[model samples]
Target: MRTLAERAGVSSATISLALRGHPRISAATRRRILRLAEQLGYRPDPSIAKLMLHLRTRRPPGFQSLLAALTTVPEAEEQPYLRELRRSAQARAEALGYGLTVLRVAADAARRPDLERMLRARGVDGILLLPMAAPREFRPLLDWRKFSVVSATNAVLAPQFHRVVPHQFSNALLLCEELTRRGYRRLGLVMNSRHDLTVGHGPSAAVVWQNMLGGTERVMPLIFDPAGAGDLREWFERERPDAIIAEGADNAQDIARQLGLRVPGPVGFVTTNRSGPSVFAGIEERPDEIGAAAIRLLTSLIQHGEKGIPKVPTVTMVAGAWVEGRSVRAPSRAAPRKAATA
Candidate 1:
């Protein structure tokens, strides 16, 4: 401690304070101390850390520990949900007295071995994964057995980690009900075949079940892929849906334009995954709340020393809220309702 303090030109007491993430120490000093600690190959002893943690239990918790959030840079066609998830996780972790380190996926993949060693050395015992499209893209980057892991969404397919994702079934039901209440009976669902699987086919189930009810029309979900939506026009003609619920606003708009239809006019359109604000009425799946919930679950796992995949993995799903826009007609006389809860 004294040596690291001397190297950083700070007192031993300051070094200890910085190591524990004491608020009294300036942020600049804490960063420099941690950087120096890393550069000098200073690995904290787990036994001492546990002992200190035990000692501090009676008092208000100080800096509890450090966690790392693995995230990716968004692509041109991608939504900002993953980034927002990581940001929310970071904020919640800090508020709970746990420091968070943000690590990029593409940038860190090449030197993963060194990264692994560094994380273990720095006592980063928890990982909050925020992969954008597919978690498979991140599987090869690290050995997961060493740390307590939590994901921001169900996007993790390969070896499913404990995750907090939006409750797609609940969101779909909410969307279907809201659309129906707005005087739309013939409703059709459109989703890429690949996306539907990733989300566990929640929307498809909702569409099928809703159409079976008293006041709705039967419209089978059109599941397409990147190869092409070759039969989209054919499907639309056959279904003649009054309103369409789609995965992407842009994709739906493209198809709608080809069909010579006006959105929110003779035909209404809604999206299941609406990112940010737009001229579309749909469900805004709250990734921020998902991230925060993941952090909360992860901290519990870490405190209990539960590392690696559990015997029976559990999922925590957050409910999404409805966002209104000009893409759909106004609701009938009955008042607007709050977001769904499940």
Candidate 2:
């Protein structure tokens, strides 16, 4: 430490802070100290450092042991995505031999006391944040260097932390290509307005559909509120799309029938997620693979004692399968063009 300080022409404290990658250290000084440490072959003993801090503060045993803190906010009802994420995380943690602790914060817990207290206590070594309707600002309350954290969902708007999300872009492109190969052209997409393009699969699917169709195909964006079934039916009737891609297969079929459209014989449909039933051609989304990947990433950070922005923030995406259901039909062969009359 003293050598690094002298070589970098900075205080020993500055050297220490820089080695820990403290945000308070000036960027120039941090860079110099890091370069010096590398040249001098200096490496801090993480275990000893933790022990010394505990000894000075009289903290509890296992203060440095790894703990994955899973957190979610209270909602009216548990969302299907969140439920699947929770199940996958717990199962992965058990397989990896790590302790998992879940913390539920109230809707307004961002400004509350309990959350701050838990952070100060160092209750966990890292956090896996689940998706929520409302954003939470808990990063400022904790020492990021002491813990590693990553958000399981793309709900983190700022991209302030590491994330593992579905590869919606590529997945959507694949789906579009498959549909084209299966002899369907006029494609339509139905999605909620509030769905995040980066986090959710809907937007990517839309972009891919547009690009794949170019100027030759008709693409419709049907935004419907579940509360207004009448508006939904009206849009379907007016558009009269040949094939529809929706989040809900059953609901889409019902709406299609209400519009006097026949499924599998005339109008066809596909689903983005095969969550409830495999009643239509759909993408699997592979939520379980996403869950397992998040665990692997978090554990890697813990095992290596890595903290703050990973050297390489991994964006792991799993592909969804194309399951054929009774909702898609082979396009009718166009009538042979009659030879021009002589």
Off by over 4 Å in 2: 1-76, 79-81, 107-109, 119-122, 134-146, 196-216, 224-230, 250-265, 308-314, 330-342
Q: What is the C-alpha lDDT profile of model 1 across 107-195, one tens digit per residue?
A: 33444888899899998979987755542445667788888899875556645788888889899989888897788998899887777
Q: On residues 21-111, what C-alpha lDDT tens digit does candidate 2 reach at each position?
A: 5445655666677777898999888998898666745733222334554445554566665678777887777665556766665544344
lDDT of 1 at 289: 91
lDDT against the true structure, each candidate: 0.79, 0.63
Candidate closest to the true structure, highest lDDT: 1
**For model 2, what is the C-alpha lDDT against the true structure?**
0.63
- Residue 212 alpha-carbon offset, candidate 1, angstroms: 2.8
Residue pairs whose backbone atoms clash in candidate 2: none
